[model samples]
Target chain A: MKKRATAQEVAQLAGVSKWTVIRAFTPGASITEVSRAKVMAAAEQMNYRPNLLARSLATRSTRQVAVFVDDFANPYKLQLIEATTAALQAEGLVALLVNINEHLDHVHAILNADQRQVDAVVLLGTSFREETLADSRLRDGGPPLFVLARDSQLAGIPAVSCDSAVAMEDICRHLAARGFGRPGFMSGPRTLSTALGRHRHFRDHWASRGIEVAELQASPYSHAAGAAAMRAYLAANPPGARIDVLVCENDILAHGALDVLRHEAGLSVPSDMAVVGFDDAAPSALPGYDLTTYRQPVGRMVETLVDMLSGRRPHDTIVLRGELVLRSSA
Target chain B: MKKRATAQEVAQLAGVSKWTVIRAFTPGASITEVSRAKVMAAAEQMNYRPNLLARSLATRSTRQVAVFVDDFANPYKLQLIEATTAALQAEGLVALLVNINEHLDHVHAILNADQRQVDAVVLLGTSFREETLADSRLRDGGPPLFVLARDSQLAGIPAVSCDSAVAMEDICRHLAARGFGRPGFMSGPRTLSTALGRHRHFRDHWASRGIEVAELQASPYSHAAGAAAMRAYLAANPPGARIDVLVCENDILAHGALDVLRHEAGLSVPSDMAVVGFDDAAPSALPGYDLTTYRQPVGRMVETLVDMLSGRRPHDTIVLRGELVLRSSA
Candidate 1:
């Protein structure tokens, strides 16, 4: 690679001190308007950019946040990633994407992020065990950690996610109003931190109305898993004794359950069986699957995350409410 | 933040020189077995991680690659991202995600990557004008750039993508063998580097067989755009003059076209109209759609990219062929 232009050369051309040139590039630094203008023009002409990696050594701020993601099968994770990355960029920080999967587990991902000295780490739609975070090496002497679009019961780790309690209440009320007597809850992997809470909310809300609820667990949030779980459920129970309404933890699972119910089980949605899901993914709005689901406040949640990272807001667990979109499926 | 353990502290604990501790952490550094083992134990006891940012200044390599992605609506992009990030991690490199969109354009993203002194840059599914790359500031004194999963006509820039020439031929042959004469190609945005080649391949291949093909352009590569384009095509042409088969640029567009043909246009697939698409996205395999499309070899392409970055392979364009998955749609 060719040598880059130096800041001293730009300062000489702009007829200003080197300190003034540095101040012009630094955010919120004190510098005269005329000096900053001259310095910027000279820097642009010479193609001089301050080396962020080199500057990070002195400031201890790399301005890069490591974002850990594992569940790529769920379409809703893409929306969360886009929103979080854009929000981070708006605050002049870059997102270092760490794909945590079977190859690279959560413990190794956290160590890599800590070694890079990132400003913070954001966990998005991951399915690692809670004991992984309990490692004292990860808990001490590292950058702050935050969770986005998922609930966290761990203390001192602020999480900004949709309020599952409110969403479950809304879904149960809608189902009860429609006079659906038998309800079943379809959940993703049990390792997910948000799974137990969603199941409890759905069951407790239904028990209040004097109705018993059934449950099924699908490992790994994917359409195939959901379809297989639904297939097994249908085979074990006869048509008359089957659950009338099925509540899925996410839209992807709901899509699979709907497909099996219609094509294989020969059941018409909302007539023979009703299905509801959380996370209003884009495909749910299509003409084929007009699913009634809850839309998470992704943009607002990401904004709150950015505010906490930048010290503009206190580090506390925040639960925001979303809208319940009613459609023909439910 | 708590103070990190220093190299001197590890050296004292291990009863060795400080340089020995550094060599134990550095890859490919020469040191005795006993000394290296002793230093590693001491470093692990105190959680001492070498500061990569500080080491980058002396080595002139940050071991980070900037991945530029813009189109999130396409589900195929997520698979490419997962494969690329995992491959990079295997090579002991990190991926710095750069989201290029209306807010952060390609030029700005490139400059940011340049400022950070990343080892290389990879452009993935971006839609930017070719002239934007002609900027001298981006071309000179910057890290090497590569394009993944997209063809690049620009000279000296290596691109690893699926062979459109071969895939189009397979699609055309499949259509002709099925006795389809009136075929139309549904294209995405005109600015895409791969659009013209795909359109040309479809038109020329059909011309060789003495069959003329009709064309329609959809902007933004979204399902809604595909639906709107199909709606306009049907409104313009009568039943007798309508094209019997439609080939979409990607699976997402094909899904929209299929939905419109079935629901609004009141046409049954493969009997009244046939639809085909590329990319073989996850939804394409669902029971509802069952689309016939091409699957890009994302893992192989990412492996080739890593080889190019690590100097194990030459910097040249590589075209890999994928399989043509057949289903009920076509």
Candidate 2:
């Protein structure tokens, strides 16, 4: 590797003291234009650039944020990460991503981030355990913690997510207004408060309308899991079941259920079995699926997150509303 | 926010100087057992954690790596990022991600990362422009740059990726063995050497075997782009064309082609129009697609990358082979 040009070398080349070289590079620092010009010429000739790390030590602000995510396989999580990074960069912040696939790894990453002294920490799609939250090591007030998508209900923790309960209520009413009678819901693991909240709201709303509701649960929120769950449900209930409309917790699960309904159950979507999904994911908009879904306003959510971090808005539980998109599937 | 405990507070409570407090917190620092015990007790009582940023200035090593990615929407890239971050954390390093969506934003992010004095920089799926690579600002020897999944032929820049030429050869042989005659290729933008390499190899190998080759190009590497490209190709060539098999650049494009064949062309996959994809992405394994694809050895690639960054291996271009997964799509 080539040796980096230092301020001392540039200072010697410019025939000035090292302090003058530093002042020339320092933003808003008072330096004579003659010295600054000489330093700039020397630095440009020698390929010398100001060292940010040393400047950060003097300035006490790195403008870097640590971002944590539980799953990278899920497209929805990927979208969230992408939007978050773009939003952070727009405000002159860099995103330090930590993939918390394992609990121990998450804790270790958090410790490392604290040691690095990032400006803030953003947690995405994470359902952190209460023990982890209560650990005094994590509560050292090192960097401000903000959880996105998944709820972290611990005291003093800020959370931002789509209003799943309200979205589910809207979906249920949409189905009812479309003259759908029996409804079936497909979901991910019950441990996720996001999915559970939607499940409860859908069940309660359907029960209030005196309509029977059938439910299926899967884990890990993948296409295969959704298909397996649907197949298992069909085998137990047999074909020609009365469930006219199927509602899924997310687009991935819905995509799998759509496959099963057509190929396995020999049912035509919307005509025989209408399907609804959340997240209005990119794949769901394809011609094959074209699923009816709740579209989370990710842009607005990201903007709000930036606002919270910049002190333009208060750090608290903020629930954003999503749009119900009607497509061919429903 | 809660105020954090300072070393001065711990030192006052422990009846020792602030230097003793720093010694107690620093690893491998020489200090008396009596002073250490007192410092530890006071620190625990006062909830004091050593500030890492201040220590980094004294030590001059942050143990952080900056990761650059071009497309966040691509699941393939996300998978690579996830694996890379996990591998980095395993070796006591943190990943700072810079999303290069726009040229100016990318340059700004790069400059920031350079200033932060990260240990290294890993660029993922980036086909860097000649001007960007040749610019003295980027070449000022800030950090060791390693490009992943892109062929960067620039001198002093190391690259690692799947052996696209050999992988394409294997795919051609496999297709020939399956008696596929006319073949069609779908790809991302030609600017990407990864896609262009695959395209050239496929076209060359097919031509050598006296087979007709059809090609379609799409920018942005998205499902909608793939679908639009397929629709355009079909409209120009009409249905029932001689192209019996379609080989896509990635699983996403293959997915869109599958939709087009069924919905637009009214042809069944494998039976009438066999479809193959690369990357073996999560969605390709769904029953709906069940796409045949080549699976890159991501685990080994990540391990090799970490090894290269740590100097366990020399910095140079290394190509790894992938496995051809036979599924129902082909």
Candidate 3:
């Protein structure tokens, strides 16, 4: 194996000092451009590297933000984490990611265990809520926090999320406008407010429109669970007895349900069964699934969340719209 | 909105003191088992939390590891990050994620940046190899290095990787045995050692068996690049070139190329074309892709890497075997 390149080796080959190589990597450092080219040429020849750690350590205020997320498998949350991290990194901030799925106590333990290494926290798809108010870490002089989607009663905190109530009502209207006869809804676990809101809104809004909901209950937001739900429904009766359309809580669940229908149950999408999903995860949009679903304005959410963290949009709530991507599915 | 629960709230709810609730989150902190259960039960009811920062600062270990990856869009790397994070969290260590697409310098900046807090660094993919090695971050007392892949000659460093060259030979032999003719291969950039190794091994082994090799090169391990490379290959060939078999560098690239073949190029998998992927990312086994491929043991990689970090494993180099998964796409 070749020895990893070093700045000294390059310096020796080019007959230049090690500092010359440093200046080449350090953008706009005070040095002759010709010397920089020479350093690069030499470095290419021998692969010399100067220590970047001390330089990084010397530069105070590394703009790395500690981003806390739950369920890395969940595409919506993944997108949020990705969007926020990309946006922050573009602005020269590193993202420290923490998961909250272990347990609530452990989740907070992670926050404290991390020891405030992060400049601030971007809480994405977290279960953390008002109960943290009494914790000294959060209550006292802790790093400022920007929560996304988590509901809170207390004032003086900043948050950015799609207005859950409005987003849910719009989904219901879209389903109703499609002229669906009988609709069964497969929603996420009711524990999360976002899922609960969608379930409650779909039930309440559709009832007023004289559409009787057949099946309604909480299931984990996964393709497996969606497929299982579809399988169970199929076992209960023949295709004729099934509902005309099924509204899924999110894309993961929707894709799973569709998989069972198309692959296992041998049903065609939008033909034998029409389906609509939320969050519009990649798999759901694949040519195989061809899922027509709601898309949260993620780029906007990241923009507003960053602004909130920087104190640009404090004391205000953000409510964004969701678009329905029309496709081979519902 | 409900207030986020705290240890104090748990104390109030459980009829115990706040200190009791604090001790509950600690793994083995001394406290009455009954009281611990009460604190936990109360904490669960109210979603109680404690300050992990103040305590960790006192302990002087962040209990966090910063993970640097090229991009999360590559499903394979995303799966590795997910597994690695789960493993770290299982060991009471949290992962801080960094996406280097928009800014590669940010990753080094984080690792070398001393003021930034972290216990160690886990470089996730090939991106780490590209950074100038002479940089101090690669050497010196920068949190003990743990890289995954072929032996990188950074003295006293630890590495983890599946047997890529041997694994490619396994696939090539299987294709040859199946009477599949000279195949079309999609290789990652020549700059990447993993890509270079896999491509070279596949070519040599196929030539040994007197099978011709038609190959395409992608910029990086990604879906778009995979699609673009295939498009270039198809454009260069005659209408009936019959490039029936494809071996992709990884799962994400394979899926991307599959999408282009089905949607754009108008071909069927396994019938008109057989495709295989590496890294067995979870989605590859999902309903649509169900790719025929090699499964790199991520669980073992994380466990082995962490054991190396914790001194459980000897300083000798370790290479693992990849599991071959055959699905309909083959």
Candidate that would win on TM-score:
1
State in Å the error of residue B329, model 2: 1.9
Error of 3 at A91 (Å): 5.7
Stretches of candidate 1 exceeding 4 Å from the true structure: A9-20, A27-42, A193-196, B12-16, B193-196
lDDT of 3 by residue, A217-272 (tens): 43665667778888888898686788888888777888888888887888887878
RMSD of 3: 8.6
Candidate 1 TM-score over all chains jointly: 0.96
What is the C-alpha lDDT profile of model 3 across B1-330, one tens digit per residue? 344455677899999888888888887899988998888888766655554444544564556677766666665565676678777877877776766664466545555433334666666765555345446544544555566644444556556878777798789777777778858888876667452367777788878878778877887777778888877877787657768899987787898888878778888887778898888877788877789999888889888887876677775556788888989888
Worst 10 residues of 1 chain B by lDDT: B191-200
DockQ of each: 0.76, 0.59, 0.19
As a whole number from 0 to 100, the lDDT of residue B156 in candidate 2 is 83
RMSD of each: 1.9, 2.8, 8.6
What fraction of the native alpha-carbon contacts across the interface, defined at 8 angstroms, is recovered by model 1? Answer: 0.77
Q: What is the TM-score of each candidate against the true structure?
A: 0.96, 0.92, 0.76
Q: What is the C-alpha lDDT of each candidate?
A: 0.88, 0.81, 0.70
Report the error of model 1 at residue A295, Å: 1.0
